[model samples]
Target: MALKEVISEFRLYVCNEWISKIPSHRFRNFYYRKVMGFNIGKDCSIHMHCSFDCAKNLIIGTNSVINSRCRLDNRGTISIGENVSVSQEVIILTADHDVDAADFAGRSIGVRIDDYVWIGTRATILAGVTVGKGALIAAGAMVTKDVIPYTIVAGVPAKVIKMRREDLTYDTKYRRLFQ
Candidate 1:
């Protein structure tokens, strides 16, 4: 294999197998910021058991909390804004294959989650989706398109259920002991 491919494989192994399993938040954040080149902001806590597709494409803002067992596919890019709360087992994808293409070629687009957004447990945010600020994604919702600001969405291929309160002032600064 090529040198670049080898290095990529090694990084993936270390991040998924070793770093994700580490109990200390400092250790994992240190590796992720310094070694993996992710742009993580202050007071951001990414819980254990979370995995990533790539390293450098993620940019997280301050005071955000990513819960455990979430899968972040940063093959394109993932821009998460401040005070965001990503619940457990949430899957955010930034890349997928185009089934309509003749060769089934791959396509990638960044996923953007605005400030004060709260994504519920097991929610799946698809590629190229832009979740608006103060929006709430219900549990198990499969978001396919852009969500409007201050709205509540639910169910598969998630549709707007209701308007959310515009005065969202909660800070998502959660730090669980030992992940």
Candidate 2:
């Protein structure tokens, strides 16, 4: 690997594996923004144990709360809009290897989560999926496709269960002081 690639890997490991585990919100936020180069908006909180690959490719909007243990693979790009809630252990992936390819070539695609989206605990969002505004993804759901706006999806493959109100207005700017 090139020197730059090696340095990037080392930085990612230190920030994601070690520094991210720190319970201090202020310190974590400072490190993530100043050192990691993530485009974080106002009042955004990324809790402990959250792992993000390629921090520069990640952009989080205002009033968003990312709970603990969330893994964000930002190898391509991940854009999360305002007032979003990402529950614990949620995994948002932006890269995957094509199984049909003989060489197992890796492919990456951007993942976009629009405003007011709520991703429940332990949910896995696959690569290239665009979660529309005001959508709710149920806990443990495996999202493999685009979710419609204001819709609720659940199950293993994440099928649409219901639709949410477009008129809904709520703030999710909550974050713990220390941990």
- Index of the highest-lDDT prediction: 1
Clashing pairs in 1: none
RMSD to the hidden true structure, all candidates: 0.7, 1.0
TM-score of 1: 0.98
Q: Evaluate all candidate structures by whole-model CA lDDT and list the values in order.
A: 0.95, 0.93
Residue lDDT tens for model 1, 73-130? 9999999999999999999999999989999899999999999999999999999999
Clash count for each candidate, listed in order shown: 0, 0
Indicate the residue-level lDDT of 83 in model 2.
98
Candidate 1 stretches greater than 4 Å from native:
none
User: Which pairs clash in the backbone of model 2?
Assistant: none
- Give residue 107's lDDT in candidate 1 (0 to 100): 91
**Which residue segments of model 2 deviate by more than 4 Å?**
none
lDDT per residue for candidate 2 within 50-160, as digits (tens), equals: 998885888999999999989999998999999999999999999999999999999999999999999999999999999999999999999999999999999999999
- Supply the TM-score for candidate 2: 0.96
Query: Which window of 10 residues has the lowest lDDT sum in candidate 2?
Result: 170-179
